[model samples]
Target: MLNIPLMSNNISEEDKEVLADFIRTSDRFTNGPKVREFEEAWSQWLGVKHSLFVNSGASANYMTMAVLRELYGPGEVIVPPIAWSSDISSVFAAGFTPVFVDVDMSTLAMNEDEILSHITDRTRAVLLTHVLGLNGLSQRLLDELDRRGIPLIEDVCESHGTTMNGKKCGTFGLASNFSFYYAHHMSTIEGGVICTNNDRVYQMCRMFRSHGMVRELTDEDMKREYAEKYPDLRPEFLFAVPGYNMRGTELNAVLGLNQLKRLDGNNARRVENFKLYVKNLDPEKYFTDFRMDGQVNYAFIVLLRQASREKFERLTELLRSENVEFRRGTAGGGNLARQPFVRKRLPDFDPSTLKNTDFIHFYGLYTGNYPSLEKEKILELCKLLNRV
Candidate 1:
């Protein structure tokens, strides 16, 4: 039996050679060809003015929130509870409180009503995650945010190629973060990118991602330094805003650049795989596909029928016996919001405020998407999972 896990890194040999060359050189500084090339490629792909590479998606999210706080500090970030644990922690790490909102189970994005209920004068940003590659959002929400003058920071970690009303998910917000973890829509081993059109955000994020070092200066900063010196601008590797070491390696950047080249094809494969799963699986046996139209699904995800803990174990054991892999669900349970650490840190916001989180823990699991598994393998896996 073939051992098909949740994900497989499909790194081409052609890409590996590119990474090997950058690794032998061993210089992450200077904003080299690979770095800029990656940024340029992603920027063009997402149709944004700037894309800043970072070590991980969590770092990208943290840096983005830090940049926001620098521009307008000590604010609140609204996020959905029924989602990845990273989305919540990153918000708190940014020195902003995370206001938990419920999810419309069908969409798995933020619940519009719950979002509005949480917003206040302190609410400065809304972090929207295109959960599981399904983009279930309406333009009405964008309009509401625009009217309120609050910025939207899209957490496009799960959704790289998803669209809403013909515009890409990552480009809709003022700034966004993308993950390239092994199981994501795409992978660069372990790397992430932050995208934004605002020059200030881009420069600040670049500096923040690299411990406040600005190798690639925006025009405004160059002019400021030039005014201080005579012929050439003096070096100012000074700390502007306090930052972190979140820079991506040149080797990883090369990998990401290669992945970026085949993103459309890769996501297309995921979309087709999702259609197959939905078409083959019993609609009554499983809940509806937690997918929205136009989503380039990152995984063939679903919600299970609510069952007893013992039955759950039996179900998983049965699948494992069949050599079919399944995910451990996305939501953080037991130790997430209720644990001593989170309770100590976030005592003000009651953990019970996120009721939907518990539901997410039990029912959610994905047969994560990857390009390596052929269509036949996927069909077999789903056929076994959909058994009555």
Candidate 2:
């Protein structure tokens, strides 16, 4: 019964009406022209050459890892200790070892210094997750990756409009993933997309998304080559690689097309709300100087200036009394290295290796910051938070 919930659906009644109309009129409801149309629109928006819409953000991550595994066989992928389960799980699923790294407390993202130190000869790529819409990558990090010839994969599932150096976050990486879940900056109810400038990666994503069907390949010559290689099988049924059916539906695309129109404006409002939150929050009690230069604030991440178990307990109690909903530890289920799923694999794992991550795990929190959040409510929430 929280008055302020951690997330609110962005889809409006007008959006639902559009979806209803499409359902009633469209010739097909499965993956069809609408999906392709949405993909093109997203690519145009992200300034990427191609985009492939999929079932969920997790699927997008898995597909990207799958492509990388094909290009470079099993190796280590640098990942943040504080990220979504899928970010690490996808790496494992693709036969790559996940090398967990500490995060910078200010940005709640992988620490650039730690990432560089962890890069070994076995390092295949760096999987950077833009946690809670924060633009975590820096030019220095990108430069280092470029110098080392290591690919950068961006997981921008929580960051739809986040930018860095006048360019959008998804555009900087070799491949980028975005989520259009009901509660993200935009919504397709449940959809995800993978964008890339690399033609090979783009075609591989398409082939993997639809049961590895050669017909999904845009290159007619490649399709014909596959057909010739497998003359015993039906041309349309040719499976190139081991793939999964992670295709998104036309209904999801119908919603995405409309959502994209309002994404930037909504992100702007969230930024304004974050400014107000930072202005009103008591700096003595919380860490408000979060890195905001190229960040598109997703949730109001409240990191306590000092780690005190008692103060955290008091804050949570006050938040409950005021009915302010929040998620502890920000994003990804917090401290992936500490999670039982990861622990089972690396039984000797030491959580202390991620110093800043351990601090956030014990002290950080985040509440909802949607477009509809008002300055007055933000002020009120800050007052409640400070009272703790």
Candidate 3:
């Protein structure tokens, strides 16, 4: 009779008051100065040169890939089977073929070996997601990708404040995406951001966020150059690239700026909560050996050590009987490689090679792990799970 839901309402009364104040006082509700302010603050927080606020995390994914395609042209994007649908969809949307790779059991990220093996002349970029706030990056992966001059695009929507080598996850890649959706590390009602150190990538993302308008370009010199290149068209109305309108509103920006202030503190609590969960879990029955050096997981990832259909079903049944909410297959519902969209593209794609992803697809489940989750509740949940 626990009745534990996956996530609690994280938006606070103070947050609502701020929104109400903004609504009462501010006339400009569209994408404007507030959005830019949030973007700059986010960039500073993530240690990136620039950031672009988008309507949603999916838009952030598509914007990142679209900018990548614009800068590097169409080719293959190496991706993990255990990722969000948008991560794969964005690649296809940008006219790049997705080369699937098996994820590591420990990190739930693209296996470094699998990624390295898939690289070819056609390899464009590696779209890596830091699933559920777990750091999906490695120094070797960074060094290898850097050596080959292959851009690493990180999808860190579920992860905020997770780090590797003292540097944040979003700062490692050519461009990275973050979401400020409900129950995440932070909330902007519904918003996302694209972070990058590269100037060209930043400029492209700015244009892409707002219908590819040259006016969106921040660098005055770039704007003038574009204006001069297309003398026939109005400089303010010029469409630099085939971009979509994925801009975040001023209201979203207001919420983001407020939530961002406490993000780091909340993430710290989440990290500790995850560690406690792993420590208390029955290791013989569950896979509790995740790479936890600098992770701030937003959810408690539970995976069976062995593939037993009975165990998996029993675990689900127990959780439901106890009114504990959970989702099977972890992030994005297990192996995205087996999803119909992927099958349509790569008809002969083999699932055998993706043993880790396949196992997770059938045996893994993630429960709620918000900052406010009680330690006693977590301990109780583990006790129930151990019985399975």
Candidate 4:
């Protein structure tokens, strides 16, 4: 019964018309030419050498981890404690241990210095999520990871169109994941993409997306090697690695192609809406000074200046009474360490280690900020939030 929702379907009627036209005109639908076309278009847009269309953002994450595991065997992966469950789960699923780090209060992203201190010889990669469309990366962080010969995997699922130093967020990492769910900056119904400059990683992702078939790989030498290794097996069905069928459909690609055209424009609108929201917010009650350099606005995140259980309860009640739909925590099932999935696995895990993450877990909330949201609506939302 909420009047204001956390997400409005981003897919436009024009995009729907494109889908209808595609369905009527196209002969093949699932994982075909349109998917490849969309992947190429996305790679060009993100300034990456290659991109793979997948079933979901989580699948892109898991597939990236799987490919990395294949390249370098299981080891410890440094991850932010305040990320989506899949960011950590993918590490475990790929047989790697997740080493959690606290986040910076301002950016709500991993503390760069803390991440450096946490790295060890066993560290295979550093999986960083650009929390809620904010660029969490710094030159110092990238230089250190490079110096240490550690791979940087970026979870840019919530950060489409975000940039750092004139470079797109997804382009900086060894591999980056993006989502095109109905609620994201753009929509493909239910799809995601993995972007990478590494040819080996790109080829691996292609094979991984389609049941590990060698036919999907573009490297002729690698395909020949696999063919020779399994002469008895059918060449088309040659399984090069253990992988999942995480392919996206042509229908989804059609939506993505149309939606991608509007992503930047929509992002700009969202950014303007965020500025208005922040300007009108009551600073005494909320933490409004978010780091904005190289940031692309996603949601209207409101973090309380002080954390209190009673205040949080009151805020939620106020929001409910005002018919404002909001998510209690930030991105990806907030403060992942506090989730039951992680707590049960690491029974003795101390939540105090991630104080900033804990603060967000208890105090943070976010509402919708889309291109369709008018400036007046944003002002109203700010007024409502200030009253809380």
Name the top lDDT candidate: 3
Candidate 3 residue lDDT tens string, 1-388:
7677899898999899999999999999999999989988998899988888998999999999999899888899999888889999999999999999999889999999999999999999999999898899999989999999999999999989988977889999999999888868999988899998899998998899888999988899999999999999999799999999998899999999899888888998999999999999999999998999889888999999999999999999999999999999999999998899888988988866798999999999999998888989989988998999
For 95-142, candidate 4 gives per-residue lDDT tens digits of 998888999977889999999999999999999999888889999999
Tens-digit lDDT track for model 2 on 1-388? 3388877768899999999999888789999999999999999999999999999999999999999998889899998888889998899899998998899987888999999999999999999999887889999999999999999999999988889987999998899999988888999989999999999899888899988888899988888888888889998888888899999999999999999999989989988888888888899999987888878889999889998999999998888887888888878657889998788877877988888998899898888999988787888888888888
Q: Which stretches of candidate 2 lie over 4 Å from their true place?
A: none
Q: 3 or 4, which is superior by TM-score?
A: 3
Off by over 4 Å in 1: 21-30, 213-216, 221-235, 306-310, 331-340, 348-353
Model 3 residue 218 CA deviation in Å: 1.5
- Give the best candidate by TM-score: 3
382 Cα displacement, candidate 3 (Å):
0.9
TM-score of each predicted structure versus truth: 0.89, 0.97, 0.98, 0.97
Q: Candidate 4: which stretches are off by over 4 Å?
A: none
Question: What are the C-alpha RMSDs, in order, of all predicted structures?
Answer: 3.3, 1.3, 1.0, 1.5
Assess the local accuracy of residue 24 in candidate 2 as a C-alpha lDDT between 0 and 100.
Answer: 89
Candidate 1 C-alpha lDDT tens digits along 1-388: 5356777767778778877776787756444677778889999998999999887888888888889988888988887765566777777787888777777776677787788778899998998878777885778888888989889999888888899877898998889999987667767888899999998888788778867654445766653654455334344655556788887877777888887888898888888887777777767656665655777876666566564566556667766787666675553332156556557777886766665555556656666667656888777766776763
The TM-score ranking, best first, is 3, 2, 4, 1
For every model shown, the clashing-pair count is 0, 2, 0, 0
Q: Rank the candidates by lDDT, best first.
A: 3, 2, 4, 1
